[model samples]
Target: MDQVVTQKPHELLAETLSTKMAAVNTLIQTRMASEHAPRIPEVTAHLVNAGGKRLRPMLTLAAAKLCGYAGEDDVKLAATVEFIHTATLLHDDVVDESGQRRGRPTANLLWDNKSSVLVGDYLFSRSFQLMVETGSLQVLDILANASATIAEGEVLQMTAASDLKTDESIYLQVVRGKTAALFSAATQVGGVIAEASDTQVQALYDYGDALGIAFQIADDLLDYQGDAKTTGKNVGDDFRERKLTLPVIKAVAQATDEERAFWTRTIEKGRQEDGDLEQALALMAKYQTLEATRADALVWAAKAKDALNVLPETAIRTMLVDLADYVVARLH
Candidate 1:
């Protein structure tokens, strides 16, 4: 027999699941439309049309496939996950007052904040409708809790954003709420919908939870380290916004008194000046916080890979392990 070579994890996942993803796209379009308020669809479409990796939805599909699911509800669940994710992005851009997303103007910029917020609410409602269609109370409970947890994470982040007293434990909680909740829910629902064993469901949840933390950490590190073209974001965007991500948190923990004042002025007080970014980078380098942050990301990525051990060995599992590796590989 001729050997079959698998492509990269994401690409292979996309190819393997292309047919289902197409169904998901169709469902997204059909559900997002609003005849009464056409502007709703217009605002929703702007962000939805903008290119995203759709990793959450793909995780749902991959989990279902890996667990030997043979039904169509995975499509609805995947769409539900994407809707939840898109609604968050729309709301996040409004909350952040951001103008750019996925290398294009945010919906709030093109339309208005009011439009963005209302449309985001609409999508949230639509996601619930789709979730209901799955006819699984466990799936509903998981996704609903994830929605609340995501909101809690964002709220916690707002409170913790510039507080110098915020520590790694709080930071981890914030990361889990904001990023990992939906990831774990996505995978967990996939397994639940597939009727997978309890152990497999737990394994999927563990994998997603760890992968999300690592992914967010790498993203935070890249804000200080990545090029604009590569990261789809300008360097120091986090610093400019006064957001206290992991790298900044690590630097703050080790700051000298003078450096603490500098962080206070620049981060807490939003008093950044011409050389503030350079100085921030200098301090992070001095404390090796960026490297420390990368190490943390690697650890989480390893946990995600380890979580896959209980599952049956298959191509999807290999891809998932590679996906975890790729998340940390961003530091390279």
Candidate 2:
């Protein structure tokens, strides 16, 4: 007998789009270089080279190719998408006071918060420059609005994450702003640059939005039950950090008076003690919130797949559908 292996959907997409991805990578490198500041590239390269999936840029490429685009603008948009994403990560690590990213020490830890923030600003400038080169006002507008939405989402989370009053609706709004906005923008701009039909572009945006929501929901759920080694995050890191994710929000909704008190102390008041993580897991299990969260993720994944009905049947499209499934498949 012979052992068999299968490449993940993302891996398959990367293989199919290797040439364009290479161009995106080259453009990213060329644009990240600074004449006066040597530290900018050093900091930017740290996170960009970290073992990220580069899924957002790939989404841009796939959407453009699926729409029959045959120009270099897709590559530019892909690089632009990546720069925006990288810049967000740099800023997020600073905002969260995070010490690690992608299983490695974060740039803020490697250098300083000032360096990370300045480099992130540099990347945002670079991303805008790349988008401007494409000469499409629609593309520029979409990305610019997404950049603002991302900032607003972060601020919302800053206020909402520790509040017991946060609900599912607020959580979804934050998700849309922080995660889905960029995903949808990345896909939508690809179609815009390719001059895709309005219907087709909307479909791409819907797919990316649903996929991003499912991706974030799944990530939040994993923080409660996921394997530390596999997830690169210790179980209940969100709980420990006092962040009110979906599972916790759902659990809080169904909590008893005593449970609510516990939540207030641990989450709202940030007075965690030993075994608090276990207690949080116990509450989630008691309410079956993790299962409910998983169900929600599956629904979004289905919506993502359904959004592709308007898209042409292509290999890239198939990979995208599978990619949506793969985003929630980790829950199993």
Candidate 3:
């Protein structure tokens, strides 16, 4: 119901979140600063120092604390989430050939793709080590599966690119794989570590999955609709890349034969030029791709809220729901 993007004076809970997330931060710095292979410290620090929201780790810590967890395991678990997220970002930049991240030159751009890839692997290994320290076999099992799902999702996305045949189903699967799997595991693992019951754990898992999906869909929507300056990325980056995102996928399904031909030639065949972006945006508008994408994001957000019905009501729980809403609200 509430918009996520429009931040009111009293709305942001970052201050409330920082206290709980402090341990998550500590875990990240200590684990990521390991002295191994010499190059590890240097390459890894590039990513570790670049400040992102740390949302994934904060979710883990907040979920654990809300569920009455008074133990130290939350810190390690939170760190694990950050490691997985950072690793994914490193690999994603490399895969996308992206030059910028968080308004700075990406690790791959600053160093080399090879270093980014290898450092990503190092983080992945350290993530597992953090999991081991948690001593929860279920935690390990959940995260191990998440890791596999994330890798599979990345490969799926790589193949899905530049193909106009990509449908909503395929696109959703890719987003779920590449994005939602880790979110699901991060929150669910927090519940598991807190010894929450199966029902609660399942609720958190669904919440994270739906939240991740909604968050990603919102991002795709912003590619066309967002302010490039605020988003810290180029407008129509997806379009210029000719990537088959949700908006493009929906547009293809609704296109006429002539429009379909244009899509096939320009997006699929690929040779993005000056006016290609304008043509792509016009096509998307003709087919209402932005609206369709927004609807999909709303559907997932509703699903995320529905999953929260199973969670016991608490300030943290309410904030998590609010946070989910805030994600989509940014698009408005």
Error of 2 at 28 (Å): 0.5
The sequence of per-residue lDDT tens digits that candidate 3 reaches over residues 53-125 is 7778877877787678889888888889889888999999999999988788888988899989998998999
The candidate that achieves the highest TM-score relative to the unseen native structure: 2
Relative to the unseen true structure, what is the C-alpha lDDT of residue 112 in candidate 2, on a scale of 0 to 100? 99
Number of backbone collisions per candidate, in order?
Answer: 0, 0, 4
TM-score per candidate, chains pooled: 0.97, 0.98, 0.94
lDDT of 2 by residue, 1-332 (tens): 12112778999999999999999999999999999999999999999899799999999999999999999999999999999999999999999999987789999999999999999999999999999999999999999999999999999999999999999999999999999999999999988888999999999999999999999999998888889888889888898889999999999999999999999999999999999988888898898999999999999999999999998999899999999999999999
Ranking by lDDT: 2, 1, 3
Candidate 2: clashing pairs of residues: none
- Candidate with maximal lDDT: 2
Q: Global lDDT of each model? A: 0.93, 0.94, 0.84
Q: Could you give candidate 1's per-residue lDDT for residues 75-137 as a string of tens digits? A: 999999999999999899999999999899999999999988999999999999999998999
Work out candidate 1's RMSD over C-alphas. 1.7
Model 2 misplaced regions, further than 4 Å: 1-5
Segments in model 3 whose C-alpha atoms lie over 4 Å from true places: 1-13
TM-score of model 2 vs. true structure: 0.98
